[model samples]
Target: MHSHPDDKSLRDLLREQWTVAPVRNPGFRAEVWARIEAARRTPATWGAWLRLHLLGVSMVAAASIVFAGAGGGLLAGARDRHEREQLVQRYLISIDPHQSSAGEGAP
Candidate 1:
């Protein structure tokens, strides 16, 4: 890399910036305290509460939805399994006359 004759080195430039102090605002502290007091005085609102507990609320809603879907799927699977069993029993009965007579007598 090439350097300009007038340009200061990176280290020197950083040192110069680091030594310079920031200007202080006279009313900065009082303004911050006033805002804090105002916030404290205000009543808690629904929107603020929701914002504060947004992550928790969303997690609960998602969990409820997942549970509802899983329950529905389980019920559907059970009903389908029961229907398939009935279908298989009917098919077996239709194919054998002796088994059909025995099943009817036993039931």
Candidate 2:
């Protein structure tokens, strides 16, 4: 809780302390802007950018390939399991038309 005698005097003091003086050198702004403009015009070439990040890109590609192989293997295993289940069902149906699936003796 500030108990300032007046708001105008306090605001004036703050402005005097915190305000940034303009650059006296007229060419300073122009020099900075020229460098920024030059950077934008040339830009980083794709070849140079890719060269800098080649390791990361290669790692991502390898991970993708590994995940694809793992997914394919999982699908193959599931398919084999389903086929085996179907074969077992067929065998049971053929062997036991009257045989209870619960191993109960048919009357």
Candidate 3:
């Protein structure tokens, strides 16, 4: 038989309620608010933000364009057709011995 009780678990200890005290210093809030206001008023900060946003939008647009182009079978069909034409031309050229001979009427 167990002589000692089981140890109180962390969960049991955390189950008790706790009170949190507010920050005593008011200057921290005031300084933070001032910085927020400064950021809002700064044209340079706003411009940088806008530029970053535009760059992100441009990247998304470019990726979407590439996806749409490839997904629509445009590039694939064109590449296949080009390859087929190249193969046909190669076959034609290979069969034509006169075309490969250097200097006309040599052999």
Candidate 4:
């Protein structure tokens, strides 16, 4: 009996037929170099970019903390029955009763 080709063998065959070539666009290269020079000349623009990046990073960090506290119940510390009940109550209060009852509140 003949054996069928496996996924790995097929992938190897496809890879063997493929060829990769470096991109060569002189116009695009020149545009990128010009942008680089322009950026270097504008120190204030670089500083503004850095400040905006830092602000964005801070916002992301704050949002991550809030999301973790909200979704993972990280602020609850441990799984006690009373805390769990309170959390469930808060969730029920926030959501529509029909939706909450439909098991949409499981997570």
Candidates ranked, most accurate by lDDT first: 1, 2, 4, 3
lDDT of each: 0.83, 0.80, 0.71, 0.74
The predicted structure with the larger TM-score, 1 or 4, is 1
Which candidate's lDDT is highest? 1
Return the clash pairs for model 1, or none: none
- Residue ranges of candidate 4 with Cα displaced over 4 Å: 1-29, 38-52, 72-78, 82-107
Candidate 1 segments exceeding 4 Å error: 1-48, 100-107
Candidate 2 — worst ten consecutive residues by lDDT sum?
A: 98-107
lDDT (tens digit, per residue) of candidate 3 on 1-107:
54334546644555565557686886998999999999786667766767758888889999999999888798789889878766765665688755544323322
**How well does each candidate superpose onto the true structure, as a TM-score?**
0.46, 0.49, 0.31, 0.31
**lDDT of residue 4 for candidate 1:** 75
A best-first ranking of the candidates according to their TM-score comes to: 2, 1, 3, 4
Give me the displacement of residue 82 in model 1, in angstroms.
0.4
Clashes of each: 0, 0, 0, 0
What local lDDT does model 2 show for residue 11?
A: 82
Model 4 poorest ten-residue lDDT run: 98-107
For model 1, how does the per-residue alpha-carbon lDDT over 17-105 read when each residue is reduced to its tens digit?
Answer: 77866898999999999999999966599888788789999999999999999999999999998787677668878898566656653
Q: What value of lDDT does candidate 4 attain over all alpha carbons?
A: 0.74
* Model 3 poorest 10 in a row by lDDT: 98-107
Q: Model 3 Cα displacement at 97 (Å)? A: 43
Residue-wise C-alpha lDDT for candidate 4, range 17-83, written one tens digit per residue: 8888988786997899999999786657766777758888889999999998786674455556557
